[model samples]
Target: MNLNIMGPLAVNELISMDTNLLLAFFIGVGSGFVLESCGFSSSRKLVGVFYGYDTVVLKVFFTGAITAMLGLLFFSLFGWIDLNLVYVNELFLWSTLIGGVVMGAGFITGGFCPGTSFCGAAIGKKDAMVFIIGLFIGVAIFMAGILCGRDYTRPHS
Candidate 1:
């Protein structure tokens, strides 16, 4: 007996672009609300884990990661989703290592992760606003440097 099973509903086909955007907006707002409610929006609370005072962030992050991984594995196994269709970035060893190091350093020094910074900013925290501004400036400088380097390397004919 052959069992017919449909795997992975096509979201793009079912949802209009506007509706998708609206849903994303609502989800982001909900996530922000939850984070703020949990005190995750506070830099002091976030950095408490590093100081060995609080481990809520670490626990929640690990638990969420593990749960998502198990859910995906089960979904794939039961033919509810195709793992091959999942997006995965190509490995660039040196870039990945450098990025991780930079991000780790930033997190340690800033006392807030990007998500937490956004949440903090949402709640009118001045420090979080500064951090967010700094991030934007950093990105702008990086882009400018990249463009300059590319121009220098271009072949002039």
Candidate 2:
């Protein structure tokens, strides 16, 4: 059987710890190699988020959105998953737009989006590592705030 990562990566486990682990590992390595080879891994390429020198990020993001929209439409048509059953977070218009702008600004300033930050860390980019560290800290803080509902949590652990 051709074990695919789509399902397993989503659910947690892969085919087996033996071949599946190696397969997934090498697959990730190979994808990173290709991204770097294609200049997608470079900070320069990411500056498209800023001065218009690059548009790959926008293109990729839009394309992925288009793909997902289409997939959701089709999947709903086929009744694979229920669309109405999915819940959207209560709309915070300001936070949504502000977050998008800040995220895009961060992309321009850091040349590393959230998704690419991990790739940068994987390939030994110091800035990427720092960015990821900051990201984790932010996430931890947010989660602790949500779970504990007070400053007493500290989120040290």
Candidate 3:
């Protein structure tokens, strides 16, 4: 049996590990199936967090974030996970601050974080799908208008 495992990458770098694209696709399918089965792919259920109806959404998310963060820190401390090889998010100071504010606003208004929204969409939530679509289009158009090159394209009499 031949397989490309961790092709061209160190054994510890799972992100760089290689495998069949088909396998990856199936893995995603399995994951989506699990999420759907767990009832995460519902928008109204997610939005219930804001109306004092459900805390499951917020609790699950916070727990997951804390779990992952703690796992990474613990692993790094024990020399299991390589801190140097980990990818750290780039900080464009202004963009990062503004992005965080926008994200927080989304959480407050939509009563769902990005992950929840994605999960909701996966289960065929029409509102989630529309929200996700509009989010992408809005960001795209906003960026286009804000790009510095727009100034040069302005009509000068």
Number of the predicted model whose lDDT against the real structure is largest: 1
lDDT of each: 0.79, 0.68, 0.66
Model 1 alpha-carbon drift over 4 Å, by segment = 1-12, 150-157
User: What is the Å distance of residue 70 in model 3 from its true position?
Assistant: 2.5
Query: What is the descending TM-score order?
Result: 1, 3, 2
- Candidate 2 lDDT over 1-157, as tens digits, reads 5343343232345345677667878988876775565556667777765677778767776786899789988867765556665554665666567667877777767777666777777778888888888788867976887788664333232
Models ranked on lDDT: 1, 2, 3
Estimate the TM-score of every prediction: 0.82, 0.60, 0.64
lDDT of 1 at 69: 94
The sequence of per-residue lDDT tens digits that candidate 3 reaches over residues 1-157 is 4343322134354453355455577877876675666556776676677788877667766886899799888877665656676677765666567767887787666655555667778667777787787678867876787684563222322
Estimate, for each residue in 1-157, the C-alpha lDDT of model 1 and write its tens digit. 5354433334424556787788889989888887898888898988889899988898878887899899999988877677776766766666677778888899889877789999999989999999998899877877897877753222332
Q: Which pairs of residues collide in candidate 1?
A: none
Which candidate number has the best TM-score? 1
List pairs with backbone clashes in candidate 2: 48-54
Cα displacement (Å) at residue 125, model 2: 2.0
The 10 consecutive residues of candidate 1 with the worst lDDT sum are 4-13
